[model samples]
Target: MFTNEQVDRFHKDGFLVVPHFLSQATSQRLLKISHEYLEQIDLSNHPLTRFTTSDKDHLGDEYFLNSSDNISFFFEPDAFADVDGHHKLVKPKERAINKFGHGLHLCDANFAAVTSGNADVSEIAKGLGFQRPRALQSMVLCKQPEIGGAVPPHQDSVFLYTDPLSAIGFWIPLEDATRENGCLSFAPGSHHDHPVTKRFVRRFDKETGEQLDGTEFISLENREQIEKGFAKEENQKWVSVECKAGDLVLIHGSVLHKSEVNSSNKSRFAYAFHLIEDTAVYDKLNWLQSSVKSILY
Candidate 1:
């Protein structure tokens, strides 16, 4: 549970880091289970969906779009090597995966134990004034050594939008996070300054009323003005958030945050999930739609 001072800091700065949120043993257990899951994946016929934060390279294949209720793997953009004009995984599949996600908390008992119906997490959600917080998504981000791609600065509300825009991210590192290993960096208080002016939505064909193949970031504001605003935000200062294993970082929905590419020899693995207020209207056009039962805590 968060203290009054911690909650105040989170509201003011748009993020808060709580040290030792989980025991080191618990963190390691999750990491071990994740690795086991990765080892079981047979990537021979995989669609090779590469996850990227860029709108141009955004993934919207069936594997990704349908992963809302199933655990699916995504490779890092740089995890492939060009060989004879074909792409080949540079490392083993277990090491090449950037993440496996979207439904771990709902489908995996190990992840569910830590994410849903947990006293501490529920208390923290209540402390943040969430009347009906739903854990909608969960993932284990594997920032593999040297190949982990950089995540561009963006707002979480864009990806997980609601009418009132109530989305919060819970990030916990299973290994030590540092500047060299792609630790997250945030523009403090950016949530207050940068409103949710765009949404990453699934496109649909007007005639057929069927979902399109890919995704797009539709502008909530004037297209020209939103582009200008985003250009200006590129120069904003960001503070790196470095922490040890088991530390929890709460990120505000609209905060501008990003991480650099992993250039270190060591890998950085982390577990993360997003929570949204069930009272708010979750946009139907949002790329992710839950197929499982609602997990309210």
Candidate 2:
């Protein structure tokens, strides 16, 4: 639970970095599990889903479906074998995984406890004034050495859409995270101004129950118009949030945040999960929708 001062800071800054949320022993254990999964993942017939904005191409059906409940991997844009071409070539599966996620909490008991038990992320949410927070997704980000990806400035509400835009992420570092190793940087109070612009959604052919192969975006406002507004506010300064093992960073849904590419020799590992208002209407069009029974902690 956070004190009034801490809560005040979060509302003002759009983010809060709480140190030592997990014990050193716990951090080590989770780090070990992260590596074990990396080794265990079979790439034999893996659907290589590399997420990149450089090409501006749409993601495939394999990425959308596999993203829901599996611990699938997505490669960084820089991990490509050839970086010059429009169709950037990917490196071998083992070497290219920028992140592997979506179901770490549901599938792993240790991770479940972090959200629901001793770590009690639920209590923290309630303390910060969430009415009915529900755990939605979990992932381990491998800001891999040298080729770590650069995440563009964006808001979480765009990807995890709810009617009133209630979503927050609990990002924890398993190792040291610094500006050099792609630690998060956030625009102080951007959430208060730019709540949402566009959303990633699932479009269905009403006549058939079959799922579509392509994903679509639903505009919350005229994209260019909203982007212009944000551009005007771009002068707002962002603060780099460097953290250590066991530290937790709470991020508001509408906050503008991004991370740089890891150019260091060592890897930076972090585990992240998000929660949304359970009672709110998670739109039918949300691409990442799941049953309340399945997502709620």
Candidate 3:
């Protein structure tokens, strides 16, 4: 749970960290499940993507491009290998995964246990003043040792947006997260000034009933783009959020945040999911849509 002081801090800082929100046992259980999934993946048949940087290329790969109603595995940019004349997935699955997500909470029982009916997560949501909250995404971001990519500063609403910007990110580190391994960083109270700028959306044609051609980045009225938005004064305000395993970091929807690449020998792993207020209007065109229930699961 959270105290009044913590709640007040969240309102002002646009983020809050809850230490030891999960037990070591629980975190280990989730980590085991993640490893199990990774072990079962067939690298020969796996879509070996070094990194998912291609918005256009993803449209061609069925596994990466298609939005299934089930859990899927997405590989890191360095997951592939150069075999003879071509690059393919290198041996040892532990070194390949970038992240596996989108529907894990709904379909994977192991993952669901922590994301849904999670008392700590629930309490934090309530403390942050959320009403009618619903889980939207469940993912494990693997900041693999050497090749972990840098996540440029951005907002939750940019990816998982709602009309009223009522989404929050619950990031739980499964292992020690430190400055050397790229922990999350934030610009305090950045949400107060910035609004949802761009959205990854899909449009359907009325005549054919077919999903629109490709993903679209619908731009909204905002002063600056994510990469270049912050001024020197604002940039100076950025702070690193280091965490131990079981610590949970709650993030505001419009907060400016990003993580550096993991250049260290140690790997950084984190379990994350997003919750949105049910009262808000979730954009229908967002790329991640649910099948069993409304995408707001």
Top candidate (TM-score): 1
lDDT of 1 by residue, 220-272 (tens): 86656645545357767899999999999999999999999999999999999
Computed on alpha carbons, the lDDT of every model, listed in order, comes to 0.88, 0.78, 0.76
RMSD of 2: 3.2
What's model 1's overall lDDT?
0.88
Candidate 3, 1-297: lDDT as tens digits: 489999888879889988988899988888788778878876676555444544454332456445335656777767566789987667467767778777788878877778776666677777777777788888888888987777767888877888787888999999899999999999898887665667766756758867866566667655366536544434547899999998889898888898998999888889999998878897667777675442322
Residue-level lDDT for 113 in candidate 3: 76
**Residue range 118-211, candidate 2, lDDT tens digits:** 4367668877777877788888898888888788788888888888878999999999999898999999899877668888767677688566
Q: State each candidate's clash count.
A: 0, 0, 4
Per-residue error for 78 in candidate 2, Å, reads 3.2
Evaluated with lDDT, which candidate comes out highest? 1
User: Which residue window of length 10 is worst by lDDT in model 3?
Assistant: 53-62
State the lDDT at 166 in candidate 3: 85
